[model samples]
Target: MSVALEVKNTYEDFILEKDILYFRVGEHGLVSFHGKNYHIKKRLNTEEIQKMTSDSSFFKVNTDCYVNTRKIQHIGDGKVYFEVRGSESKYTTITKLRQHRLKEIVLQQKGEA
Candidate 1:
């Protein structure tokens, strides 16, 4: 079985770990998956989400956004991009300080084979 986040939204109910593209802070919290965004109703914050997805595919890219490195298409111009199947592409910013770390993580994954 695939691991999934317990946060519930008004749509499909829950988000699967592998399908998550990223999570960002909003009125509450927002989780992006498969080209769609889900508003988190629970009181959980970005920090809490980070802890739950740690050592997994998810990496906290900045203060309020956590990205699934496996879903990343490319990183450039201070932005991290992802392909959204049938929808338009999406991107989120990566902090200058954290860019190196993100690169290391992506490169490390590539070398694992």
Candidate 2:
């Protein structure tokens, strides 16, 4: 299978996509990617990072990335590009099985699903 560039491990151990909205996956957590290259660093996991969202804006876009739908610029190339709050060029890929559900969630957030 051909993985998308957005899914590449650019941040070593950190999985970064959203600049503001995020979630936890394992022993560590994602803070937020920033600056020109959208480089991200590791952060101590916090309760806030794992908080459950009951709204349409926040959902899991990938295995370790939960995003606010409003932060997305577009979805294509098996990935989700973001017009995020901090970073300039960070994106994430949804699992193939979840892609359709992601579309439904995105559209539902806009009342178009």
Candidate 3:
């Protein structure tokens, strides 16, 4: 589960508003978002991650990292599966559980399931 909140930023007497969003998990995980590395204190199962990435707003750039799909540059698959765009490099390979979940997500996203 995750909590969604609103955020307000002020700079030079100017105020900017944004959403304060976070994902919840039992253990912490590593992620890279918008060129910055983030330590996700919440741990989530592969199925949850897959569901999250199914949304257009999110993308599974790697097995351990789910990025915003809008940020993806390109996707490649082979012995070394990866996604690279600009300064971002994401790995898509993972354990069997994650791999299976990823495949399900992909199929769901493509409307094949």
Candidate 4:
């Protein structure tokens, strides 16, 4: 059976909400948004991003980026990687670890975790 899940949280006067997005990636890689690509100061590894994903305080969209899910627009996957859409970026791909964590988060959001 298919279940639907929603993630919601409030931080520093900002309200974040995330809907479940599904996709599959073959190997892990980095992704940058259209405008923010230049400002990527540092990239978080899969393990670190995974931890962030479970915090309930952060949102995990793709391997390369962890948005508050509240900021997600959509999720898609190509032959090599998965992409997540935000307010500006057309797509963002996540890492392998975050991929697994995303599944767990979705399940948790559905109350199945």
lDDT, ranked from best to worst? 1, 2, 4, 3
Q: Estimate each model's TM-score.
A: 0.64, 0.53, 0.30, 0.32
Structure candidate 2, residue pairs in collision: none
Please report how far candidate 1 places residue 10 from its true position, in Å: 10
| lDDT for each residue of candidate 2 in 76-103, tens digit (9 for 90 to 100) | 7677766555555567777777667877
Which scores better on TM-score, 2 or 3? Answer: 2
Please state the error at residue 84 of candidate 3 in Å: 7.5
- Candidate 3 on 41-89: residue-level lDDT in tens? 3344677555655655553434344433333333335211334444455
**lDDT of prediction 2:** 0.57
Give the Cα-based TM-score of candidate 1 against the true structure: 0.64
Top TM-score: which candidate number? 1
User: What is the lDDT, from 0 to 100, of the residue 35 in candidate 3?
Assistant: 26
Local distance difference test values of all predictions, in order: 0.68, 0.57, 0.38, 0.40
Error of 2 at 25 (Å): 4.2
Q: Each candidate's root-mean-square deviation in Å? A: 6.9, 12.8, 10.7, 13.1
Q: At residue 1, what lDDT does model 2 achieve?
A: 100
lDDT tens digits by residue: candidate 1, 1-113: 99988775435655446556677644555544333443343446678755655747778788767788887878777888886443456778899888888988988888895
**TM-score head-to-head 3 vs 4, winner:** 4
Model 4 bad stretches (over 4 Å): 1-55, 60-64, 70-90
**Judged by TM-score relative to the true structure, which candidate is superior, 1 or 4?**
1
